[model samples]
Target: MHVSSHHQPLLVALSVAVAVFTAYVALDLAGRQRATAGAARWAWLGAAAVAMGGGIWSMHFIAMLALVTPVPVAYDLTITLVSLALPIVVTGGALALTARDGLAWGRLALGGLVMGGGIVLMHYVGMAAITMDGVVTYDPGLVALSALIAVAAATAALRLAGAIRTRAQRAIGAVTMGAAVIGMHFVGMAAATFTFHEGKAQRWFEASPVEAPVLALQVAGVTGIVLALALTSSALARRSAERKAREVEATLAEERQSSETLLRQSEERLRLAVQATGLGTWDWDMARDAILWSERTYALFGLAPGSAVDYTRFLQAVHPDDRAVVEAAVRTALAPEGDGRLEAEFRALQPDGAVRWLSTQGQTHFESGASATGERRPVRLLGTILDITARRLAEERLRASLQEKEMLLREVHHRVKNNMQAITAILQLEAAQVADEKAREGFAAVGQRIQAMARLHEQLYSAQDLRRIDLGSYFAELGQGLAALHVGQPVCIEAAVEPLVCDLDTAMPLGLIANELVTNSLKHAFPDGRSGTVRIRLFREGDDVVFEVSDDGVGSETGERAKGLGKRLIEALAQQVQAQLDINRAGGYRSLFRMPGTRFTAPDAAVAPTETVG
Candidate 1:
């Protein structure tokens, strides 16, 4: 059959129009394919294949109608119907393969081969259905070239279908793909050859055959319906995508609002906590040389709330004497070798010209150059300052009260010592005018006992701590005084006393007891040039103390046990201190007083004088 130029231009234009429309719908479906999943994704793929396949089938039939040959041509109904089904099957498979994520080159190539081979098969099969008293042959080289063009066009179409995104890009891709499809169809048509018999009777084609005009009308009707359905589906998919995007945006907006609410609540709670604890917060930006102080900080510094102050003002508020110390502490905290913690107590000069103590604690944060230099450049310093003025004032008042009490105690002890000394002087004066020798000795003994008590008050007045007396020193002095007063001949007085301390109540009783015992020893232990040693030993014994006064002399006579003032005084004093008295006369006269180590409470009144023990 010879080609006629009369209807060729119209056929080419119709083919191009159908191919372009098919490419447009295919690209639109491909764009929506990613936005769908599961059944929806397959639905879009099927829709794309139907739209493109129907258009391809329509274009093939329209182009065939344009063929003007010497003999009339008709298609076999069965083969043509089978040919129409080929594009739908093959395009569906190809679209499905390329629609998934991570499209592999091998899989895409295979899909191209399958789809191209199907198109070639469908075209040749439709041609084979032509029965017009003739046999058709294909130019092998032209057929091969056409198949190659189909494969190349299919591969490019699949790539564009998967890659195109924007509407303009999609349009461009559709036009390019349309040209490829049209080129493949025309090239395939060019490969066909037809031969007619000279005398064979014509066999009118059956099996659901139709004329070219009827086929063209059928193809146009089907293409129109398929494209309209595709446009409706694409519109619904876009609306669904927009609705989902709006829902996601609304969820994000709600989350942001919730986060802001929580932040405000957290800040409010922190403010309340700081206020309750009377903490003053501060932030110092070292690089900017600026300071931010909370309301409590201004109050702590004796300034109005919202008062502005910088590092220089802070230093000015510090007491002159403490300024250097505060500066040094801050420097140390910001030093590279430092631990970044600060704790300092310093006096601040308030606006009222009064000095107040402040306890400040803070931490330094290094934002940059922390590890690189001689000094760590602090990004910020955050901490609290507390007004410790009330505490300091209370402490000062307490210290003053303590000092005043100490002075009062010392005065009382001084007055007591003076009063006892006055009693001793009166006794000595009365002894000077005594008429009886025994009476004079008694007065002198009484005076010595008064002097012993005066010595205790004297120790209390002289010492820093007046609560307790050094018993060892008191006893040693007492022993020496008694020896000097009573002994006319040389009698060595030896003291073996350990370090012991006792309160005034215990000391007074123990001192009087020692005085009476020593006086008795000095008066009776030796007689008429019988020089001997009197030994006093005061020492700890377990949880008790033993005070022993012994003399190396003849023992007391039997009649001496009848009556004596010294013996009565010794027993009375021992009872007051809750001590047991033991008199030993085996080798020499020895008197031992054993008392509890603890301080004894004062008795209600003086005890009744006890019987003399010799």
Candidate 2:
């Protein structure tokens, strides 16, 4: 066996790698002890042992190949086996840490002793297998030191496993193992130097062997540092994994408790809901003639406590007139075409001769086995019963009130329309005799305003609800009526009305306003055979209802329409409706008003629109 000095570095590097890997295996095992339990930790320890054993074998082969001495194949094989056993012993100790009943102090001590003895025996046996072709030397001190190093490695591993505490303690344990590895490496190197070469033997520890001690020192130092670093890395990894496991377990526990609490709350809510509704639960067996009911159910039937009420008793409670119907419902429920549960509404006759209606519904549950009679035991039916008498009475009252209100409203609208027509005729007849044109005009305006108000009620009566009217249609109708009222040079009135509906509060004021605007447009807008157009538009803007009326006619007469009753009325009406009115003479004449919501009432000095000849 021969090798260049370059090969020596390679061999030393390989040995250091193996030493680091071995420390990592020990560190990982120690860290996992606190994190994993049961079979997992044991399985991990075994797997780590197998990995470290492979590393050990690799280190041994590399070292054998780099040896300057020609070592026999048998010797190399024996050395490989001895190196492999060290990791296997460390793994067994790690597995023992996870045992349900941990290894006692005596057992740990005994195991360590056995492992140390085996290492010593293997070392001596492998040493015997070695044959140095030209050197034969044996040093008792070197053998003793090597045995001490092996014992020290075994002791460090056992001590670590026995009392591994915090991550820091595990790190210390790894350092201890690395130190033991370093010690064994140098001790073996010193022992190798004692081998005779060309009838001469050298003692490396004599402090005079520079190459051997320095190389050995370098290898031991490097291997120890690498092993320590590897141990720290593995320990940190295991500590992090353990912390994560604990956090996850805590989260899962909290989630489980939260879910349980939610489920309980839901169940309590359901129970309270059932109680508040005055509903009683019942269960019935169709075959065995068995019936079960909650206390509420018994109270519903006007029965005292401890009273037994089977299907027969249940049937007896039904009124004679409704008995056939109740029976038919049960028959339908039990039939093949229907589910084995009855949902029926029927009258129950109490002992006091009072009749009460009950709504019963339930579902059926089939038995697992047949009865002695070779038939399945009667399926059970479970359900709830609720008293719906109050609901039925309220519905009846609502229906009757709706019909009565409809009839009364229609009659009221008809009578009001007839009276308004009578007033209009009376005013027309009276106006015919009026000699003054102003008085006649006043009476005509009065009748038209009255008609405008009448149209709102008229619209309501015809509408589905006598409470609201379509403002657009109501305004348009009033405008048309005003145009028809004017005789000379009929005004060309245009109503641009939006489709809007409001309750009476909004409709009445709008209708009257349209009447005044239209009357003014016709009376003064077109005069002396000159026809002009009057435009009235109404629409909703956001929350405000706007009405605009424009007339292309003669300007306002001083002290005439502008300062007359009509202008006063317009102002008063706008104030009553909480509306703002803007009068513009920019383009002939234009009046605009906007109101919020639908609260309108008649106002004082509510002037009618004044008439002016163009």
Candidate 3:
């Protein structure tokens, strides 16, 4: 008996087209599932498997309904249900395995094999579901070829689904996967052979041959509707995701633009600040042996703008005397033990042969790279230079002016001393010419007073500080001169003059007072050639000074002697210095003068006189 499918060519073609279209939709859904995460991914996988399995089962039943045989055909309910389940289970497993991240080739091949085997088994099982009056047989060669075709188609479809990424690729892959599924179904159908009896009856609990076609059509229509719904949902979700991505990109672009604007503004402010301060900045790359100087730096060095120079040129511009010093300072700052700070003031020789004083402050920055054995090394020197020539010139001029003034002052003091000495000589010569004792004594006293002031100018001239006199030395010299003048009396003169300094204003008055007191003691205190000692003391007492002159001799006939010209001169001199005077005549004649607001100290005690003979 000849065994063949009596299915109508038009219905068979329609069923194949529906099955291929359904496969395309399922493959598209599976490709989308790869982008989903967690539970959502599984949902997409389940949906895709259901659509594909339903489409395959629907196509099989529709094609079966198209078949016409001599005896009526039916399907076993249990076996038909099992055939529907096979595709769904196998498709779900294959999708799940392919969804994994970094899916290896070995794993993909294993999944393909399992899925292909299931497809082949489902096709044969569905064929077994047919219950008829005749026995059905499958040609061993054709059946094997059909099974091989199913496995090959299933593997190819899975590979396409896994590999497809972009929408265009997915669309292409969809059509490809569709062809594979449709081809497998037809090849399996061609492998079947059925033998029919003369009379056949449909068994109980079997599907009616005529009604199966209508039911198959309904199932195919429902599967097509479900697939259409899934494709629509996927398209809407893709559009939503794309819209969100565009919004994010727009926000990022705006942020980047804002950041660039802020950075440009900051750099502009820094450039303005550097220009305003007249700062010449420099950056030296030690590793590259190159130097970058700001525009102001070229101006500072008397070079035109955009003039390029290396480190050697920079060094050559420095004054010969200061070049070594500047280089050493830079080296020290860059040394490992150094603190990376540089400070130097030196002279720079300009192109015009003009000298300029420059003050530089800098710091070294250490950076690590492939250089220096991967260790941090001083890679750059950043610094600023300021012109200081104006300040230096001003200071030099001030110093020269001070030296000229000091020289003029010394000359004035020398002239004053010489003029006063000449006046004293005139008075001494006049005394020598006078015959009257009172006149001689008066002239002698006047000459001594002149000499005392002359001595002050002398001390001022000899001293290192022209503004002040060493009073201790002045006093000692004054006492010895007074004693030398009073030659007749064998009086021993002793001085205990402590180291003290006083200005010309104070020294002049104090010297005159001392002159009168000492002269008076020599004149009257030691009477009738009696041997005695006269003592002079100049020392600091608290914040004041004490100038005392005392003589060990017979007391004066009357304290009335204090009222003479000598007394008048002493009183006048004391008043000028703002000093108080005290006289003692018990053991000897003593005159103690104290001047306030005098800040000076003696190395020894002043109250207890340590006498020195002169």
Candidate 4:
């Protein structure tokens, strides 16, 4: 009846593999059925029962395969009961979960207790199914071990279910439960081990009746100690986890409160700042044409604090002339033609019968299409407005001041020009009285300088405004004056000039140099009163102003240094104006000057002047 060691390894290996596979299939089927949402709890329980039944059958078949010798008739019946009872206990455990009938706590407890009893019964049945030497034997130790395992499994499941709150915790609970069940099962199986005599035979009726009680007591003591420790540890672990969860929840709630408090304080500060600055806030409902304005905005409009305002009502407050412009600006702000910000300044009629200018500036904040519910409507117009009445008045005063100053400047320049004219006339009379050749020559130079100053007055008086004078018109007049003074009838000095502008600083020096050059050209070039054109061209080139005077009368092939007093006068005047002077005597007498226009900054010389003398 003894089994050889050689067969033992193969039998044990096969038994372990089959047992593991059976456990896997049962758990897998139960898990899949339980995961189906909206499915009846009883349906899943029934499926788990079928799966466990299959597992029990597999376990039995595997144990049977390990049999090298046949079992006794009584032992065979006991083993069958143990195998059947194992699946029944597991099925009852699952059923306990489904039979709540709205009395959850009580039903779960009853289910666990019943399942534990089934496990104990199965253990005793399995112990009774063992035979050696043609004798049947029962083990009390196995029954106690099975009872301990059953109680541990049921308690662990209940603790796990209660401990988990979230899905993640529930998943961990399931894994922990599986591990705990496996561990308990193995512990119980280990405790069930006993040595049997293969060489002896015993009578079934009186075989070891006293020994059974002694063994059962020892087995019960061991099981009781182990079960107490397991329960104590499970309770401690669950309590610790719950305490940690409560701490985490408190910390989160405190953080949320702090954030809300900070947001409220920030909003209050913003409100105060807007109020202090007299800034008016408004919101427009595009669909309803409704407008909501802050209290400060109502004050700005000189309306009562609780005035009824909408798009049409707001527009009515605007001045009639400015209404269309303000409306157009609002339309542009909501749907702008370009990316630039929208701004408009318009006069508004206040409730107190005062007309005040107001400037508004803002950009659009687009609405989300999904948020189309009451009070959750999106914000569109986000902008501010300021009462600019004072600023507009100040600007008007500044403009008036500027106009008065310009008029005074023109009068001053006009008086200065008249004084120079008087001085020139005096110098001309003094030159008429001089008799000495050298004295008269010196007097003529003095007279020319006085005349140069006099010419400025003449041009200033003739000009519409005295801020600036046209360089072209001034030069042409100088040329004509010189021709009339020196070159008479037949020579017929003609000026071909282009328009240019010069301020007072530039006009003075340039006028003197022009007079000297034109006089020299008339006296020297038109020797026999030759009819020819004298061209005076003034144009801008980069940052410089070019002034050139050319004549077509006399050929200037003779190379000689220009020693005439007028020629020296021209060079000195050109130098005084900070201009480059070039006198070319090729083909005809020509003089060119290039001057920096920075010193002659434009005042009111926007359009070039057009004047011709032919």
Candidate 5:
């Protein structure tokens, strides 16, 4: 009988297909070594080894099944099972060693020894399981060649396993690895030379050997299935890890949302506070030159609420006369040397032509981005605007009313002064016609006193502040009038007065006291035609003002001077002003009135005359 060695084209092709697919699956599974760690790593590693080992074993067995001879051939059950187990165990351990993250040449070589040794053992051992077959012999050279190919391919595949990145690279690597594995198998097959023993083939049917074609189909199908499962498991594991990561991210997002919610609530509360105070806020982004105004701020600027506005528009809306003031204030606030404060009171011109008095206060805030020139700068301008039109209008109206009252009061003072002057003129005319010297002197004294009162009214009517009087100026005029009345008298009136100011009430009593003292000095101080000086000195002593009038004439410790109507009037006037009165006759006739200084303003140097009547 004649037989051809098993080289069935279909079986060879089937083995090659299994080799290629298993190589791809192993390469794909290699990613798991990186994707997983701990116990999970070992699990994926086991799956990958199965695909690689099974493919090598299945390819060899299918090639064996392709050989046909006149003698029957069957495999020993124990040896065949052993051959399959050898590759799975050896490749698993080898792959685990190679999966140590980096490609050290020693580790790769060691891995190749384990993987190639197991594959060679599986081929030779499965060949040994053949029962009723002739002695299978191997060509030493070809056998060595097969082992070399297996080892080289295993080492190359290990390098590619870690390096595989994209689908195309993995596919290319798979094709190359598959070719080496298939080539190694075919080389091993070629080394085998079967020498049949005639008549021994009849014993094959007694053992009931399985059909070789059916066994080849089973090996190819099983190898394909195992490779598919390994790849599928790796993909599922990756998906599970990603899902857990997504869950963690979702949890973090929720916490972030809560924080943002609290911030928004705080902002809302601040906004409500501003609204309650009737303040309109503005935020300006200086970098963008953009202005964001609160609803109330828009209304304050006389613009339609919620409308878009910029600095240019804001300036246009300001009253023309006040525009420069507004610009200058902003410029000062933005200056590098200035404090970041802005204050401006300007009139805002509305679209409808109504004008509003607006007071704006702002603070500039600096930030890194506010750096227009890549350094620190003021980037934000935040402020408030208040409508002060009502307050301003009220102030104007009150001022006008005060002016009206002042004019009416001045008119009243003028009328009183005119009436007093008319009475003085009548008294003077009547006194001039009288023959009695004592009576004429009495009329002249009364008329002079009345004139003094009229002069006070004249001062009040001319004063800018009607409620206060300048005692220095008033006394100067009073002294001149009294001196004029006593023409050719031996007394020279000399006043050394400070620029003292006092209220109407205090000044009136002080004026009358001065009049009484001066009149007495002129009437009684210089007896026997003695020439002397009447000195009026007004100065401040501590918290009281002193009004002193002295004369270098007749001395008086008098209770005698106190008996007269002028003295009585002086005492009453001093008492009315809450002034302490002292009479000293040791040096000369001196009367001092000390009035509380609280009723007087500080002496004004500006209002003091360069020259005064003596």
Candidate 6:
């Protein structure tokens, strides 16, 4: 039997509209699936597949419901439910395969085949659920055509779902995917053949197995549930992504603020340190021959702030005599063979024609690599300069004062020598006039003491260092003079003196002490014309300066010497120099004095014996 059918225009339009909306929902869910990971990704894929299957089934069921037949049409309850699972399971597999970060041709082709086969089964299996007294079958050629259409539609739908991203593109993809699904449904419906016997009309509307309207309502409810789930999940995902974005921006802002605060503090510290040190900084760009000076640098050169300067201008500001040397130092710093270091001191000429000494230090920065036509060259120079005018002027004044002091010291020594010589002359004249032998001896002794002082000043006047006097040399010379005092006495005075240099203040006291001791030894120890050797020794023993005078002639009695002027003089001189005097007369007369806390120029001064006869 031939069965004639036509679709209700409004229902057909509703079916098409439902198909498009379902495609849109499925696409939104797939987009969410691609963005998810772990278990959530599979969850979204299942949701997308269920939504797409429910939507495609609803479109096909609604179109079928729109077609009016001559007999009442009903569906088997179990088969109708079983037919719905075909699209869902197959779509889930297809989406899981292709809905990811990427898609490949092989996966797409395989997914299309599975999806198309599932759709064909969904349509035909749905037809088998018909519970009429008629038979349902399909023409082989039409069925094959419907299968091809399903395959083409499935391929197009998967491609569209994968490619769709923006709202505008999604809308277009939804419409196109909806049309492909609708075409597959129509082709599958066209392949179906309904064969009815004459009694099939009697079973119409008599407690039909499944009514089309009730089934339509059930499918619509399922479609609504899938739509609700897909939309709500998408909204929540969008909200989560936006919140994360805001958090990241806030963290970045905080980090930026902290970095800027540190940078500002560092710059401020550098500026303050430069100001406190009176240092001026500069940077030079060699390629442009341009110079950049800090505010302190401008003040150093007596130039206005923000004034442009170059190497030529810098040389013009330098003093004429020191300009050439400064230029040479800069060239050396920039030389390829050098370490790019510079230190130079020169005079800077201020605009007011006054000169200020400037000390500059700098470093050059060179290119890391050579250019095509040349070797590496200096690209930039950084440096600092400081004013040293006050220091230079103070040094000059100090030098001049030192020279003046030296001249005054020389004059003092010379005048002292002349004054002592006149005193010695007076003492000599008095000694010669004295008739009493003992008093004449005293006068001669006083004259000799004065002569020794005169010789000291003379030696000091011509000495290399005015502040120090060579004690051994002075004592040796003084012994020669002492030996001259007793002519024809047949006594030998041997002076063993060490060349120990001592401060000038100790010279007079030490010389006078030695003179008295030696004079005492000669005057009394070798009495009755008997001759013996008198030894005068001066050397450093341990931490003390030692002076000893000893005689082999009958050792002088200290009891008798205590009443003489020489003994008292020796005691006074020893006290003046803080010396401890030890007198020993056991073997020979040995008078020794050790001055503590005496410093010598050399720790070990060579000693040599100097002899004179009296």
Go through the candidates in order and give the C-alpha RMSD of each one to the true structure: 10.6, 17.0, 10.7, 12.8, 11.1, 9.4
lDDT of each structure? 0.78, 0.64, 0.79, 0.60, 0.83, 0.81
Give per-model TM-scores.
0.52, 0.45, 0.55, 0.57, 0.58, 0.53
Better of 1 and 4 by lDDT: 1
Tens-digit lDDT string for candidate 1 (283-399): 999878889999888877888877878999999999989988999989888876678898888998879987889999999997555556545567888899998889988999999
Candidate with better lDDT, 4 vs 5: 5
Write model 2 residue lDDT over 1-614, tens digit each, in one string.
23112236765665655555565556565445435667766665554444433343334434434454432222344554665565466545533543334557666666555545545554444444444433434467987887777666765665665467665775666666655664564465456542333433543222212343354455445545544554565567666886888999999999999999999999889878989989988877666677888778887778886698887898899888888998998777655445577788877777788777788887666554556755444466789988766776787799899889888988898788879988989999999999999999899889988898788778877877666565556666676676666656646777776655567766677677778877776766667877787877776677787888888887564425556788888888778678899877644578889888444222222222322221
Clashing residue pairs for model 1: none
Model 6 residue 424 CA deviation in Å:
1.8
Q: What are the per-residue Cα lDDT tens digits for candidate 4 across 6-95? A: 123444444444334333333433443343435544454555454444343333333433334332322454575566657555654645
In angstroms, the error of model 5 at 219 is 34
Q: Candidate 3 or 5, higher TM-score?
A: 5
Top-down TM-score ranking: 5, 4, 3, 6, 1, 2
- Where is the poorest 10-residue window by lDDT in model 1? 605-614
lDDT of 5 by residue, 1-614 (tens): 23347678888888878888888888888777757789888888888888788777888788778776666677787998899899889889888888887679999999988888888888889889877645777899999999999888888888888889788998899899989988988898888887766665345334335687888998788877777777887778778888988998898899889989999999999999988988999998988999999899987876777798899999999999999999999998887667889999999998889999999999987665545566557778899999999999999999999999999999999999999999999999999899999999889878888888888889999998898788778888888999998888878887777777887788777777777788888888887778888888888799988889888887776645556687778888888888898888865689988888877776546445323343
- Our model 2 lands, by Cα RMSD against the true structure, at 17.0
**Taking the tens digit of each residue's C-alpha lDDT, what string does model 3 give over 10-122?**
66876777777777777778876877788888998998888877777777767776777766678887998999899889988987787776778877877787778888888
- Runs of candidate 4 with Cα error greater than 4 angstroms are 1-249, 268-276, 367-379, 414-502, 555-568, 600-612
| Model 3: residue 73 alpha-carbon error in angstroms | 4.3
Enumerate clash totals for all models, in the order shown.
Answer: 0, 6, 0, 0, 3, 0
lDDT of 6 at 414: 92
Predicted candidate 6 versus true structure: per-residue lDDT over 1-614, tens digit per residue? 76667677767777888889898888888887887789988888998898888788788888777766776677776887888888999999888778766789899989988998998899888888776656777878888998898888888778877787788988888898888888878877788777667745466434355665666566666776778777787878867977887998998899999999999999999899989999999999988889999888888788999987988899999989998899899989999768999999998888988888989899999886655657678888899999898999999999899878877888898999899888888887888888999898888788778887887888888876777787767877887888877888888888776777777667788888777777877887888998888888877788887878788977745555545777788788788878888988866688888887455565244445454544
Best by lDDT: 5
